[model samples]
Target: MAAVPMDDPGRTPSSYWAATAAAGPDIPPFDGSERADIAVIGAGYTGLSAALYLAERGFSVLVLDANEPGWGASGRNNGQVVAALKHEPHEIEERFGKERGGELIRTIGEGPDLVFGLIERYGMPCDARRSGILTAAHSAASLADLQRRVDVWARRGAPLRLMSRSELESQSGTAFYPGGCIDPRGGAINPLGYARGLAAAVLQQGGHIRRQAHVRSIRRAASGWQVMLDSGSVMASRVIVGTNGYTDDLWPGLKRTFLPARTPQIVSRPLRDNLRKSILPVGQIMSDTRYLTVGVRMHADGRLHLGGGGGTAGADRPALYEQLPREARRLFPQLGDIEWEFRWSGFMAMTPDRYPRLFELAPDIAASLGYSGRGICTATIMGRELARWAAGEAAIDELVLPASSFRTLPYYALRGPIVEGTVLFHSLRGRLKTPG
Candidate 1:
């Protein structure tokens, strides 16, 4: 793993979302002992959503975070609300078996509905748009894979359409993609605003969120669990850890279970009306099929947001983001020398299988993390599943993704060099236009 310093809770990154989103709710840091039915660590989307649902179910929920809600990847993400996992529907069924896999597919496919439904229900101030999401194919192999995806989803009555080269070029305003597909269920949101909105909704539902409450350890107690903080302790019957990529030694070896990959993003100054009209005119978010996926989207205000997959460590430097502008120019050559105004990075936990996990760390302690690059929608739905399990409405085995023992990724410590090499290999392959 990387030797990066922990994020400073008091300082949110100067990303575009932080600058444009509304102010987060005024939350005080932990100051005194607290007790609740459930204690949640990390107030990202998963924790906040779980706390909100648990609070709604009349459980006393206490959420503690090193920083304010949405300060981590939850706030910094590109905000594309994709509804499916990395695998195709058939691949999922082949892996998890017919029954469980079918259930998982159905639940995951409804992820966008859960996200958009929450926004509508809470009347969140986030710029929520359900315009759609496009997956552009960078190669012929990728295009064929997309065709398979479209066929499977179409059989299931999903609102997905495979696009020809011309259609994709027209919609994305770029001739870079050979083909693509659009999932109308997916869309975009102001991620920071959405996280803040979730925090507000949790508070409104009587959930307690304490910011700057760095949890030092979790120990067993006669009552249940004791979450020791920098200045206070929280005792609850159960503990939920939703730290994702910011995960540390909070739980023994939890950080080793997944690889942490940094994703860097750059935002351009709002484009002129003519340029804006020429690019992504349909208001859809897009990501290509490259191994190092490049994500692009248009802000409601017309700023061009582009992100690239960073290596395993030390991805916070400005120099690491220089390629983004080049990529933007490659996609939209007409926008020559556009001034990029914001550059920032966040970590996403990558599991071996690229699927998020629900792990049973202890008798009453549950942890969920490793969203790969699909945190917005997956985390929201996972939080509800966690809430159901915590509330005893469903057993862990009956959850959508059953809780399982942690299987630490082998060679986890060497991830830095490993990821760098993999990135290099993929980059070379992509340059050569080799099959994926």
Candidate 2:
């Protein structure tokens, strides 16, 4: 791991997420004292989702963001609306106990349901297609791992099927996979469009959303929680912090439990319709089974988004991302003629348990962050649940990830180097490599 600037050059949105997505209507920052039933400290999916549910419940809600809504990971993700758990359910049951852990498993598997349902109900223009996700195994041992996952999910009544090499190659664009697993409930979408659409829906529901209101500090007030922005202040009965990897200086030690990582993506120039169809005829999105997975999706517009590997400001970013074009050429050699267009990156938070944390920082100030890389769907679902909880309408059982508490990472000051080193070694060794 190498040290780099906390901020980077042009770490904002780019790639296809920007091209097809519209910027959210700008909302002014908080300028004066304010009161609300709930104040959400982010305008990403988590905050927006919380606000949407809060508004529907007829609670007064205000959302504040440092930048435009969806400018964070919410808008700039791989857009793979996948629903399968990153870990197995039985393992979840083992860790958190059967009752609570099963609930968590069910919540995550239902994450995509919330996303697609919102898309249909709101008529969001995010290219919300309901196809399955395929995760491949590159080696025979990896195939055994897939078999274990298949058995585990099947025993838990999940709809998963393991595929042979032929089936894997058919679903994927190339013969890069020996085998894989498919989730019928999985899908993909235009993430930026989805975020913008959610903001619009939140506004239509009479919720208040403000941008450029970077929260400086959050403390408990005599009545509830006091959120102080750089320019203004707000008091709310409940506070929801959706800052995730950007959790930053607002809260000490919390961010250390989760590793902040940057994943890069590339979008090729649009292709011939025939070429696109040949690659993803069924319009499915795919990723590998490696610890750091590479997720790819063929768009309706004859383009593909290539994503995998992890790094950030502190570590030497991996060179694997540059291998995308060659990988794509292997997948569809005919794609050699298509010119490459945009390449960009976004940061995400990861927990060692590979599940998100939803806990209270104070009596009334709750936070929902640290989704690892499953942000596209999980963050939205967590946001909704967080809203319900804040409204006093939902219980801890509503949480998707087990809320069983653990000690915070021991060394807050040293976590970045520690986590980055661990990830860097495995990332380079390809020991964590997924089947493509």
Candidate 1, residues 1-436: lDDT per residue as tens digits? 3544265335789999999898988898899999999999999999999999999999999999998899889988898899888888999899888899989999999998999999999989889999999999888988999999999998888989999989999999999888899999999998999999999999999999999898989999988999998887999999999999988888888888888777788998989999998999999999988777888998878899998654546556666787778788888998998888898888888887888899988888888898888899889988998899889898778889766677887798888887677767877777666322
**Clash counts for all predictions:** 0, 2
N/CA/C clash count, model 1: 0
TM-score of model number 1 = 0.97
lDDT value, residue 189 of candidate 1: 92
C-alpha TM-scores of all predictions: 0.97, 0.91
Q: List the candidate 2 regions with Cα displacement exceeding 4 Å.
A: 1-12, 315-320, 330-334, 395-400, 404-406, 431-436
Best by TM-score: 1
Cα lDDT for residue 296, candidate 2: 81
Candidate 1: misplaced stretches above 4 Å? 5-10, 434-436
Model 2 TM: 0.91
Candidate 2 lDDT score at position 103 = 78
lDDT of 1: 0.87
